[model samples]
Target chain A: MAKHSFSLSPLSSFILPRGDTLFYLIALFSILSLLIHHLSPVSAESRHFEGFDADEIDDFGDSDEPISAAKHIPPPPPTTTLSVSDPIESHHGPPPPSADPTSQVTSQPSDPKPASTSFEVWDEDEFEGIPQSPPSDSPLITESDTAASAESDPSLKLEPESEPESPKSISSYTVEIVCVSFLIMFVINYFTGKKENEKLALAWASKFATKDSIFDKNFSLLGVGETDDSPLLLKEGQNVFKFYASGRRFCQGLLATMELKSRHDLISRLYNMVVPCKDEITFEVYMNDDAMDHVVVAVAKKKLAKTMQKETTDLQRFASLVSPPSGKKWIAEELAVVAESKEVAGDMLNETVLDQVFGDKAYEKFGKGFISMHFSDQHLGSHKKMLVFKFALPDAKNMADMTRLVALVPYYIDLIGRYKLSSHARTKTDGARMKVAQEIYKELQNARQEALQRKKAEQRKKGEEAEAKLSAEALRKKEAKERARQMKKAMPKMKMTRTG
Target chain B: MSSPANDPRQPSTAKPYKPSPVAPQDLPIDYSGFIAVICGVFGAMFRYKICSWLAIIFSAQSLANMRNMENDLKQISMAMMFGIMGLMTNYLGVGPRGSKKT
Candidate 1:
């Protein structure tokens, strides 16, 4: 096989050697890390907020006074731990009343220790100090001072809030890793697959190129090397019609149009005639690439003739044979009336005249530039089949093309027969009943011999009369010879006297 | 020489041609994928926690099946992404009664 110089670049060579497994491994690892990050519970500094029930929040919202007011308030300062520790005094103190009368009303009536404890964790410094209960007298004064101080300095507490957002950063990083790995794997698979496919295609192209084999006639035919987009030109003078190629599909289509008992028999017969065991035959429909004019026929086989016949009959049962009877009758009457008028003028109503004046009638049934021919059993009795071919011409009416096609039909039949015989021979089944091909050949031989004997008998009949005439003429010639001999003897005496 | 498998009692005809031009009611629909898409929609639009969880599970199962499928990876991945987004919408309470509205 010829070698192609196609090659990958050095960069691709480096990556190609690593193979796709490595990329998949990386992707697998990335997915695993993402899963771990999503599934595993990291110790979130902001706390899991365990026991923070939605129902409890709903209950709080419904409680009306303190809870509704608390829902509006921002989370209290970390220093609120001091205020919470001094809860006994703070709840009753003037600061609570000044802060919100509603909070004092609800907090004073309900237990306030748990709510204050929940708010104490806002600052790490206060979280440790929470264990140590300080004196309420000093803490109460400091708590009020710190609340005012904390309100003035909220930025000092922002550090703890930022610390709890670590999990968000990790999740974003995991998302980025998963996306990048997925992209990398996708690109590697796509390009690697594409490259391998291209290499395989190149290998196949090289093999076909080296072998000088025809993949299909649509690609190349005759001596005309196909340009990428050049049109085929088949003309009469430069190139003649010949067999180009054949295959199963062509034979199947051809067989479909023929009135054969079974597809099996038709195929077997065609196999015998064309290439043995091959089901199609391709005749060169074009002459040469440069030919200005050529004829091509594309045979499109429809349903089997038997099925078509059944369908047509079924359709006929639905209505009269002359469908739309009134309109058809009117058209027939018009044609007849026109015919009468032409006849009265002694003008001819022949096909040529009608075709010239009223356009071709054949075209009305078969469509424009079409000719239909039916091959009867007499022509194809060897196969015991009939075929109808509808030929569409591209040019003016030419009988020569039809004649050529008819001439080729017998050759195809004979070719199919030979093909079948060869196949049967290969199978070594000579004991099988004589095939149609052998029968046809025997009949042809017998007919030829009979015709030869008949010609010889007529020649013999004429030869007998010629023989009798020749015999009588010979007898007369003998008599003339005897008479001449006697006259010669008598003449010798007269000669002697004359000489003396 | 006929076998019992070709018994006369059975219907003689083979199965009707699939992919026929006539009624194609036999065509299989991906019910799992359909459910997932519905759940995803409900979760995103209404922030229904149950719907979001259902969508997540269905989409995960679909994604697992898609690994075995030789084609349409991109489409299945997009569905998985939508499922993820729906889950997030429910988790973050991003709906008509979400934190933003409050």
Candidate 2:
């Protein structure tokens, strides 16, 4: 049994770790191909031309025989006769054949230039040999003279020069075309992949936040305070969230504005405070391993800022102290939860983190319809400074859901802070933990029920009061009618006595 | 009754020699270098830019391994040189008939 188990283990391991085997095979094949390439060298004999005589045999028998035959016999005689007939045929009846042939034969050699040009028109290959035709007519003509004239003719030289240059240009063009096409495809693919990743991230965030089926209206960017650099395209205290609600995609976010006593990197401090307790408990939905590196406060576009906002609802989805928003959208802005500490804890507290954590203008940086919030300096009369926390959803359709999430930001921060401070506050056992969570859930449910009941009672009271007022008014009108009738009867009697 | 020690025809065994199974360290065959050279050849032959780049990358790796691996120094250097040349020329598409020299 032991041997069998050990044998099975090897098999399982080999099957499980497939990547190693694949790499090994690839390396083996490459080495094999190389050895084959080296041991049996490829010769250039397959590519080399055997001899020029072979080309002559193939060229002469098939495609070029007519060109050769036309060169020697018919080109000269026909061309000369055609030239003579133009003058003779116009003057009188067709010249006698006897005189015509003799006259054409004499005229052919005299006008060699026209004869050669006409032969070239009949067949292109025939013109190639015509250069030698002039030389053949009188061998005394020097070789250097013919060469000079051939060089002088620009058309003759253009063909050979252009042919050699073609292959070089084609290769270059292929490289350029492949590179350009690949670049275009890469750019397009990158953008599409980025968009797909954002969508996936949003879906993952939604598990922690709100998930409302009904698409709501009234999405807007509300300016909370004053800032030099703001994402919102609005004045202080202005609400631009719902202006484009009709034509806009739905987005949700959390925005918190508070006053701070002094200028500090509050968000970094909060992160540091939580770092100690991160092992015991985790905000897995809002926090990733990379979140430590990603905490940044910067100006972003409205669409980008509201990418990670969550939908809002009355009830808490998760039984945590901080009720994370219903569903999350991609938040374009970097958010920092504010905290203040006198001394640094470890090397973790770096300058980059501090710069990323505090002092961001959420309103002006993001445009209208963004999840816009800001901190006011002048408004902090007694306090040192103000903190404005905002969360933006990418494509939020419902305004009510976003507003609800925004309303929960303060509670979320307070609960999160509380959890961080009392790391040992959790129950000892799983059963105990469950009981505590259930008790809290029950309490929240009770509170919600109580609030609903109170609203119903108030509405009932208002209805009763309105009904009473209506009946009392009717009674007063009836009483007045009775009194006027009585007064009218008395006035009539009095008018009768005084000739009324 | 057929005792080998007593038999006149039996041959005596006196510590037979055992041969080593593994090859010597100083052999010129470096698998990594040869693989790189092969990649360069195929890439140049097919005019594949990506493969040429692969050849360049593998050749760089081979060069780095030259210090550690037990390959002949001359052969390794030659392979590296050829690999690099093949990569660049193949990428340009102008070596000996559009880099068709496999």
Candidate 3:
């Protein structure tokens, strides 16, 4: 017995968990489907059941008076004989005597009339009796009949009978309520967020980009209409605004794009809560070929400066971190610089600009908003000489805080456009660029050579594999055919005559 | 420094700066990427496996030929989130209503 019990333990443990999970899953699924089915529009069968239950309950209430009155009267012999004829009728046949007086008084005094009327009332009462008599003589038959009727009709009878029990059914619809609430929240956030972003962008444009503003005096804002009263900014997307300015002294054009976070999307809003980010505006100024000398300089926050050097193609190839001039202290402890040479860094970060913009007092006011500034003459891609400035946007209420930073765009545009490299610095920059170009060319050539060699080796391997796969007899035949071809080539070409 | 316009000795007329015209290269909108995001959102909300799988496929195609990294990355991430959410809800949750009835 112990051995048998031990053997059964493994089987029970293995089968029980799976069986339990399946059973629970099926139960949950059925419950969910039933809830959905009931919540749908009322069907014909449900309407029929509702009307039938209401009428049946009223009829039973009216018949109760007659049933009580007939109980005192003596039972007729004919009614008793009819009750004993059928087993199903006999189960409720004792109640027939009570129904007989109601049929006799309401319909006719004839004996056949009483019997026929009594049978008709008892047939309807049989359906009602199934639920009423749980302890009847034949429970199996009654239980099966009650279950079949219950399956056809919903258990919603209690809903009309009692008002307080309706809340129990409502509690089961929590899933649908939650899903609908989420959809509502998403829609509300989308429209409100879009309007807010548009308001911020328009505020920025009105403050810094309109007529007589810093941008208007330095660069031309092309108007859509003939008049200058046209809008100064173009709304490109929900969160992106663009300002195109041309007619500057040294640059071809300036494209300023403000890229805000996707506040309109619910998923993006949720993601932003976990991983914090900032909205930024970038300036891309394309310079004329002769406007800039050989200089590549970048100044940024220490953390971002490292990323720029790693990610930017031109910065990675042409610039490296540089120290300040011998007697001068670095720009700021929080700042980092990457440049081709020390002179370019010095020329770019001069005394006047430093005191007005990046000094300790000014840095405190504007440092948080300032992200990075990169100026490169040998920048890769279509435009070789370019200037890029990135700044974080403050809230719309504080739009005036960035006046000094915005002014720097035109200031640097004029400074770099008019400035020229020293003779000594120019020679060094030219030589460095030439060396980088030569190294890139050499790398390309080496890659091509390696590819060619790889192809040759692949071909040789294929030939060997084919030979190895051949049978001995097939290999001999191939070799003999090759030998015959070689001998034919070795001998001088001879004219051959075929005789038939 | 004297302004050229202010100098009496110089001519009053000075040419206004006219920038050289450059060709415009307008980037086309990524319709497939946007479709993927919409499909993914529907899939997650309605628990549709086919829509979720289509979102993933369109996202891959969008990523392969991406031109702008910053903008494309944001759209791609949103699509991926909805697609994965849809798959998790369909396979790992109670599944679709039709499948449950079967």
Candidate 4:
């Protein structure tokens, strides 16, 4: 103990007032540690747990040159020094140097060089990597770039070391701020990306985007491409034109749209590929999916109208044809046959067999009338009556029945005029019905002509008829009076005798 | 593990050895260095811009129809989409929605 006290150097030669104070604190603590070490039980027993360490054993050797640390305890100021240098090597330096480099005027060297050695002590400054950064503009910033420098190395998991003054106190408030800022940035970026991606996907899907490119292609290529875009159109068109003359027809509405579109079987594969030509093609675009139904309906409507028109024109021609010179023999033969067979059957009369004998429409008209005789006697006596032949439409309200009866009126009239002038179908049915209907028609025509002629004569005779009648009446009356007077004269003797 | 040479209580030095500057378990971080890392990663991903850019080029039907001399084009768009998605997912440590958990 005496030797130790004698060997103690005056580290006050180097220590500042504050440094000396901390130095004595360390010395006092070290002495207390030594006294505790020797005076306490020597054995490693229950009092000392696993982490407990003794520094008294290190007193002589570890305290060798750094007499400032000769007490075998590090001063607080030196531990706090911020150096870019390594701590362990610097802590082994001369007595006052290893003690405290932290107090700006007290312990740190005035020259930054040898102090640079003491600066190395900061390498041993054990922070949890939470640094104390001075203002960035400070020249001390250069001291922080070092790869292994104590002030330079970031010891925490998050945040840049440039934020050393960022409050090493590690408050809950600071941590929360960092987390919230990070979360806000993440959320903002996420929504922006999501919305733009959705728009891009939609714009990509729209088909007019490519339709401009599909132009100028050939029919088959266009068909294939069209089917590639939409298979429904091809399948529909093929179903309609059963005997499709056109190669690779692109017509839609030719087939069943709804049914086939649902069936994706392998067999429909070939039909699926047919597409339309890209040019001015005849296909009408239907908004509805049932493309084939409307196509057939449009075609049928056109055909029915055409047939009706043709039939009307043919009947007109046949009416005048019966008067032709060549029509004589045929008309006679048809008239004889109809008279023999009371009812001409079926559309047989409407057909051209006996029509060659009579003219066609006239035969059809007459035969149809004979078939519709049921309602022909509606004005008969009150007794309900039955006809000789039973008709399917007993009422004659059947369009066929009505057409037949009404048609006979003109037909028979026409036939008689022809028969009177020539020999066309004067058979009993035709001749009899024709004669009666002819007589009626002639009487009607004569009456109509006479009435019309009478009207004309009335215009000529307005004054003449009245004057002629008046003159005749006047002459007769004059003659009668003259006779009366002559008689009286001739009978004068009788009159005298009568007077006598 | 008990070595007399490493006994802290019987430290042979003239002075007690201060513990190492820091505990061994703590990582050595250079927070300034991470600023460059953040910039580099963001720049690379931004420049990669693979999906948006390639889609625009293909017009969303973004087919890479590389034709042979005979002019036969091959379809490789689907595979490219998967590859790009895989790269993005790996960096994020996750998989896409509706993917089977294998």
Docking class of 4: incorrect
Model 2, residue A395: distance off in Å is: 29
Categorize the docking of model 3.
incorrect
- Alpha-carbon lDDT of model 2: 0.34
Q: How does model 2 score by TM-score?
A: 0.21
lDDT of 2 by residue, A1-500 (tens): 00000124434533564565456446546755654454342344323423324434343233411232223433334234332344435345655554433233232243344444223233445445553233122222123334456667854331121111123466656754664565455445445533443343333223222223111111122222232122221111111111001111111222222111111222222445666311010110121122111111212243432331222110112111121123432222343211111111111122322232212432233322223332211121222122233444433233233333343323322222222212222222234436646987999999999999999999999988876778777879978999999988887444335555
Winner of 2 and 4 under TM-score: 2
Encode model 4's per-residue lDDT on A1-500: one tens digit a residue: 00001212334432543654566456446644643454344343424432223333233123322222212222234234443344445456643433333423222212212233122333323433333322221122122223235354544212221211123355735633553464454445445533333332222212211233211110122221223343212212111110001111111111111111201111122234464111011221111122111000000112332342234332122111122134232332223221122122212233333453234455455443232111111112322111112111112123233233222322322222222211332243344445556776999999999999999999779767765767777879978999999988887463334554
> lDDT of each prediction vs. the true structure?
0.34, 0.34, 0.65, 0.28
Return whichever of 2 and 3 wins on lDDT. Answer: 3
Order candidates by TM-score, high to low.
Answer: 3, 1, 2, 4
How well does candidate 1 match the true structure in TM-score terms?
A: 0.22
N/CA/C clash count, model 3: 0
Q: Candidate 1 clashing pairs?
A: A233-A288, A234-A287, A245-A282, A247-A280, A272-A416, A272-A419, A272-A420, A273-A415, A273-A416
Candidate 3, Cα interface RMSD:
21.0
Off by over 4 Å in 1: A1-164, A167-176, A209-211, A214-500, B1-102
lDDT of 3 at A209: 75
Where model 3 places Cα greater than 4 Å from the true spot, the runs are: A1-170, A221-231, A270-275, A326-330, A366-368, A453-481, A489-500, B1-102
Please, what is the TM-score per model? 0.22, 0.21, 0.57, 0.14
Worst 10 residues of 4 chain A by lDDT: A291-300
Model 3 root mean square deviation, Cα atoms: 18.2
What is candidate 3's TM-score for chain B alone?
Answer: 0.67
For A137-224, candidate 3 gives per-residue lDDT tens digits of 1111123234456557764111112121112376665654555565567678778777787788777877877767767666554322
Chain A accuracy as TM-score for every candidate: 0.20, 0.21, 0.61, 0.13
